[model samples]
Target chain A: MRKFFPFFAVLIVFSMLLAACGGSAPTEAAPAAGGEEAAPATQSGSTLQTVMDRGKVICGVNKAVPGFGFLQEDGSYAGFDIDFCKALAAAIFGDPEGRVEYRPLTAKERFTALQTGEIDVLIRNTTWTLTRDTELGANFVATTFYDGQGFIVRKDSGITKLEDLDGATICVGAGTTTELNLADVFAARGISYTPLVFEGADEATGAYEEGRCDSYTTDKSGLVARRVVMADPEAHVILDETISKEPLGPVVRHGDDQWFDIVQWTVYATFTAEEFGITSANVDEIKATTENPSIKKLLGLEGDMGQKLGLSNDWAYNIIKYVGNYAEIYDRNLGPDQPTYIPRGLNSLYTDGGLLYAPPVR
Target chain B: MQGTVPESQEKIPFWRNEHTLQWIAQFTVLAGVLFVFWLLYANMQRQLEMLNLPISFKFLQINASFDIGESLIEYSRSDTYLRAYLVGVLNTIRVAVLGIIFATILGVIVGVARLSNNWLVNKLAAGYIEILRNIPLLVLLIFWYTGFFLKLPDVKEAINVGGTYLSRRGIAFPWPLPTETYATYRWVLWLGVALAVALGYALYRQGKKTGRMPLYGLWSLLLFLVVAGIGIVVLQPYVMDYPHLPDKGFNIIGGKTFSPEFMALLSGLVIYTSAFIAEVVRAGIQSVSKGQVEAARALGLNGFQTLRLVVFPQALRVIVPPMTSQYLNLTKNSSLAVAIGYPDIVHVYGTIINQSGRAVEMTMIMMATYLTFSLSTSAFMNWYNQKIKLVER
Candidate 1:
């Protein structure tokens, strides 16, 4: 008891300090701006200012899926989603090589990482679903790629179509849209199949290769990428069927409207740049001499749209000059020219008979 | 000790007083811990509110919108996430229970074999323990699932056992089908089990008082079957479906099938855990005194009887405590099912967290589940330990 005197004194002081710090935390976060919206104002402000001050945006992405968010052999990320991360950085810092930190995450860890501020934006090949949109407290910026669930089977397996896959054992990544869609579509078709789920697409592919499953299922885009890595590419084929709509895109946490706007408009700028025939190479020339009001406004030659989103006037110009237009990003990663080619069917510009239509820049 | 404290020697200030300071120290430490916890709670609340993320368990009631590969209970995409979680819990418990039983049997056998007089048997048991103990469990799980299970013949050339089959898909066995009349049959079976238990207890009590060995095991078996036989005759029509080799599909048609994931996970858990349990059992058996065994042998008990009646009872006393921990380990280790997608509780909750983004609430539920499992296992083991403990006058 006599020896405990100093310990008690120290403990009392520690508790006092903890109480003082905890007591003031709530009030400390309360006085940013805007009465009812002050929380979001401070939340969004602090996040945006942090990125600006830190000079790097932490982006969560998938390292496994090729053409969307694959980490290349050169120790650099090279994919469509990687370009989106670069585009966001370019919007903020006016340099495509702006300090962007990439945190490769799995499907299980991605959202929680975003919610915890471990990543500022998630640009993985994530599908926008109702539950994710409404419940996950994450905001989908815009659809970058339109994909759908499809099956890849050995050509000799005689599984030519979805109907032919009845009673088949399919390997899929657990917790993915592919897994859920497979269940929904199979049940709807009144076909029974054994689902062998894996945590990662890599493992599922490994199992598929070993013949643990009759077929491997994932996004058609993913299937293409996975198929290219097969031992014999021509030996397997992706079925010509799309089972579920998978609108893949970039996602940011909710409550940061300003930051969300920065990411959202950054993606939209790519489409608008493409819509106006402005590629990365000619973005500077167009910004300098364009007379078109929409292009001029979009390139930030007119209007304070960037200012409204708490960015510099040349934010759109920076995005185009750095990350290129949407078509360039797509063609570089997933076009017919690439090994993992995916047709730009619904991902093309609206005028090209696709569903990708950006809201008017003005 | 009380008298050593000189009474009324000095009237010290409360802070300087020994007993007062000791109480103060404890209370201060507890308060400090509580304050730290409060700080974390406040910080989480602030972050959640700032992010506009509602913290609620209401999402558990919403439709899962996902399908599990295998379920023991009725489950569909329309079922609530809570139901899905329940299915996962049931699956986990099933595996844990099965793993525990199989591991115990194998552990005891290998443990006994480890000390066998036969040099070959001893070396073989030692080899098994050494090899399995050295490798990481996850590596083994992946190896078995891919190198062995996946390498099995394709479904078209499944290894046939009667009408059942084993292939890369999985193994299927004949299972009794539940029909509309199964409810009545189930009641009859329950009644039979209850009656058998009562009669067995009566026979044991009679034998105990009379100092004669009771054939309680045989009597219980005969009585159970008699009651069940009467019920079956009354019911007249019962149905059982045998698994049939599929003519040309990847799955069996009529009977219950164990998914490859389940088989891999179960085999991985059982084989891995038995190695550690085998060591514990070996130590327990070795801890028994040689004098006691010799005394039993001097009493004209045969070697087997000396082991069964003398050595085993003592060894059990030493074994039960460590065996409780092994049971808990097996239960906790079942979480590795996520790697192979066995749809255990962790895997299911993980999917829920990914889909719904209720990371905080879902994590809390997961922690609570494992905590409950460990606590219940320890509680049961503690009760059994107390019963088996030697009474000292």
Candidate 2:
């Protein structure tokens, strides 16, 4: 018996191992994809109200995808997704600092984390799709960014368009709509292609640069991001065709219409802020002097909107003061005034006809 | 095994005993653990209901609306999610099976080389083992995929090895084509397997009955090949699926073009694992005593016979346990395909998680996959280990 102590210890460890393997929370078995609809009301029940009452928001986003979500070198979340998260926190709790917690997620883990209620809102530049909404049981908010699937190829390859590359091999990141869409669009067109799938964008793009595949496809923004770092930027060509409809947006699980309403209104508030000529730099001065009724109502002076949503009267004002509005966020993070210099394109204010329209501020 | 004798110094009272406390402590701990798990589970359920992250697997029945890159079984966007996952399982098994074969061969060769008297072979084996074992497998996979394979020239500039297509895209080779197509080919497959089994069994019976040295395994293999040839003639299920260039325009629609992800991962795991196996083999070989070698020599046996009959049979006793462990490691390492994007079980589950928006569920699935893999591998290896274990005197 004494001699068998080691075996006993090992047996104990192995049994524990089995237990650990089997012990994963059964609550998360996500109903085989289609069985989700019936349970929506139950899932979104009390958790939404608790988050609202707590006066802080848990936001999940990616920290690696270049334009959508990324942690800056200084260790703060900085990207299109981050800005939107900040906007929501600003609208809900007023001060972006005390009101928000940013949780970074990988491409694969984002959906499950959302479903498990690990985070309140997912502001990642995730594509809104049929399966995701219906099967995954997530409720998508307003479409924040309109994107398309595009490809990048070497300059000398002389691959002018998608049709020219019929028999070409295309590289794409794994576990993404980018991968599925690549196959679908090409196959639908009767063009044959072999897909070289990769786990990470960095790896996929590396292979593309090394000429492993004749072409590499991803979101149009990702193509531009990869192209900029190439040895010779002018050498690569982005094909003119945008194959898929990518309505990128913020998401939360179904239920809690109140919280959902608050998040949706936050996104609109930014666009409205921009329309009202509010920028982070001048928000303080405008509050002191601006007497316009519309501006005052937006800034929470004349209207009881903040009370209706259960927040401080000046929640939008604080959001504008701390996080800035739509145009300010874009210029700081992407426009020519900043580093990445991504054009404001479709993300500009609605008054200027670019689709960054906020719902009426009333 | 010695029975447990009560410790000499501590024969205290009934309730005030260390043994009694030990049982109490264990029960308490067990109860505590269960309580904790229960509380955690309860909390999670509450939060889930509160957040509206409805759980469902109805997604499996619906069209997956996705396509996998390299599939052994038929997979299309039109297929269900379950089919996609099945394809992933097949891909994992494919690489794992091939990796084990190559690693075992390489390990035996290198293990012997390490014990060689020749300085070159000995030093070379040592260096190979050291280099491979030191680097992490994840890093090696990346280096192989990115620095080596992916850097190779495109299809136009691909390095052709004896007319076989080897490029960053994949390795293409000549293979049999289906003359009668896949549906009719089932009979050929069944006939081929049946013939192979019959051939092996007959060879075994012949060896046992004739009392002559019958090359059982080899003879049976040959017979099986002949049967397969007849099956191919009768069924005419497939033609030569030549992987010639014209047939591989954009994709090798006929012959399989093995992806570089599969190749790089397979080679990396095999090479890395073989180094450890080499050490195990070397130790096993050395563990065979000097007396056996001398006895073989005294019997006037040649070098090969002495090594094969006496030394090898002895060494196998020590070799199997560690070698089984190596095989288990290779299977588990197949999950590293997630990092390199090989679309193995982990990768597919990851996509499921992302698509479904269920993190805990996806993670549980990933854990279950590796756990199941580990159990099956160990079970098979242990059974084999028992089969070859020495009958000690």
Candidate 3:
């Protein structure tokens, strides 16, 4: 032990200096701020301050969920979640180009990454569940999209709905809420099912395609993207009935209530912008002529909303100008006209008869 | 320096004394290491508190609410986190215990066979060691599971022979029916094993008195069967149970079921480690002097007799020490059970760390468990090694 100390002493000193110097840099602290710290105050909760100080918002994402959170062919992250990542960056630093650093994590590793302060905020389309919020010590903000359990079966199987398959094997991801829902749905229908659980969705989808399992069950959105790679994509059909509510949203660790409110309100700002007839192309025009008092206040044209949140007066303005409002982001990624071709469904603004109602800024 | 008295003595200052310098260096390093460790711990505590993470281990008492696929002791989701950890510990033990025994036996055979004069046998042994050891354990685990085992026919259409069920689920053989009479099974098995051991001792004692130890294995086998037969009769009517399809579900309802996951993981571990152990044993054997075997052969001993008496006993002194480490390595590598979902100690603790948010405590437990296993195995082998030392005549 003694002979090794001189060596270890140098190591200790070097590491200490490294940590101190690292605190000034941006990358290393992102995981520490976003992960196991379980609160952002130690690292990420004062996110805008960190970004302003460091000039980047660290975003945790998933590269597997195509159209929601996935990588494109060109080695860039592009999906619905990616847009929100841009939205958060645009809202805070007022620059959408390079203010965000995205780290894609596996489904099981996402929460630990957030708790340990690795990322500033998690926008990985994770489900908001009681166990996650309370027991795991994470705080889920407003829902970004409301989804439910659905399945896709080979078109030749002649199975169309949830109750159609009785003894068929279903492939689902292990350690996911999907596993539990798969069990409950089969139990409720008085049908017995063989659940072949894989560690990841990619593997499960592969197994299903190989006919190891008769069907694969996940969120309907996931099923669509999964089927595109199948040998016969048109042969597979997603069940119409959605079982088990899955409200996918962003999350931050508990504590730092102030930090939670900031990320939450940023998401609401996107919804609120869409509700007030806001779009990236029209944002500049509205900045000059918008007259509604609440809208005016929200856009930082009236009260000191920015001061209360420790943000710029035109924080929401920058968000709309750069990232676009909620509808614009959705249409670009998951809209029927987009390559993904998913319906807006519950993601539209309240004026469009959907559930995306944002609170009044005042 | 020549010193002090008229008798001429050497004296050195404390710092200049070699012994004193060594001591000082040791203590200084120890103190510095301890200080840095304490500092890291303090920083962790401060960070954890600052972030308001529940760093305390109050959550271990909470219900785990997660069922294990394979458990030696009774485990349920309703059990506490501590119980879940114990289940993992038991699985670690179960795999390690069986793997060590099987690897040692297989390793010795292949090790000895590698030097065989026979054309077919020597190359085969060499080939087995090279191919298995060169590939990584994870690849072999996948090969065992998805590549071969998962390709078994589904349970509903499973192959059944002589009341045994074989399917993708895994091989399920008949177990003794758990009847009131079958409760005496332990006594019968133990008594039979004890008799066999006693028979071996008797043969050794007879060898000391007379000039020869008869075929002790034969005596031991007869003793085991006689005792086992009598015990079985007394413990009467032990029935056999076989696996069959459940009336209303997909699960197998009867007989002893082995999940394919456990079989694949264990086989991979055993095969990979055995290959290394085989090389160790071969080197140990080859290191033994040819004179030892020549002397035994000149004494009119046959090949089997010479090997059992001369080659193996001496070679064990070398083989046992490294063999102990391979056993410990197998124990630690059991953590790979997670990749294949075997739910060993690391996997359960990983979940506990995630659920309870007790990273420091859980990590300490994992390290301590492995360390204790390694130390205990080393201690046993060390004792055995001392007993086998070549005492100078």
Best by TM-score: 1
Model 1 lDDT, residue A276, Cα:
89
What does candidate 2's lDDT look like per residue over A1-362, in tens digits?
24544654565675576455445433333334355464444333345456777777889987766556777689887777888888777776666776778898765667767776689989877888887776565788888777889988887877788887887777887667887798788779888776767666777777777776788888787677667656777888888888997788898876656667777877777778888888888988888899888888878888888777666678788778888887777676666754356676776776676877777778
- As for model 2, its CA RMSD to the true structure in angstroms is 6.6
What is candidate 1's CA lDDT for residue A137? 79
lDDT winner between 2 and 3, please give it: 3
Interface RMSD of each: 2.2, 5.9, 4.7
lDDT, candidate 1, residue B157? Answer: 79
TM-score of 2: 0.81
Candidate 2 vs 3: which has more DockQ? 2
Candidate 3 Cα outliers beyond 4 Å, as residue runs: A1-46, A134-137, A149-198, A204-243, A284-308, A337-343, B1-24, B160-163, B184-186, B215-218, B229-237, B245-253
Put down candidate 3 lDDT per residue, B1-393, tens digits, no spaces.
323334454567776666766687777667756766676666677555654564666777987755455689987556898998998899889888888888888887888788889988999999999999999898898888777667878766778898888777677888877568665777777878987998899898998899887888888999988887887777764677877886543446678977776788888888999899989999899888999999999999999998888898888888888888888888888778766656688767766665565666778888899898989988988898899988879
lDDT (10s digit) by residue, model 1, range B133-209? 99998998887787777778877777888867788778877776666777898899999999999999999999999
- Candidate 3 interface RMS: 4.7
Clashing pairs in 1: none
Docking class of 1: medium
Model 1 ranges with Cα > 4 A deviation: A2-37, A283-308, A360-362, B1-10, B177-240
**Poorest lDDT segment (10 consecutive residues) of candidate 1 chain A:** A25-34
- Which wins on TM-score, candidate 1 or candidate 3? 1
Worst window of 10 by summed lDDT in candidate 3 chain A: A21-30
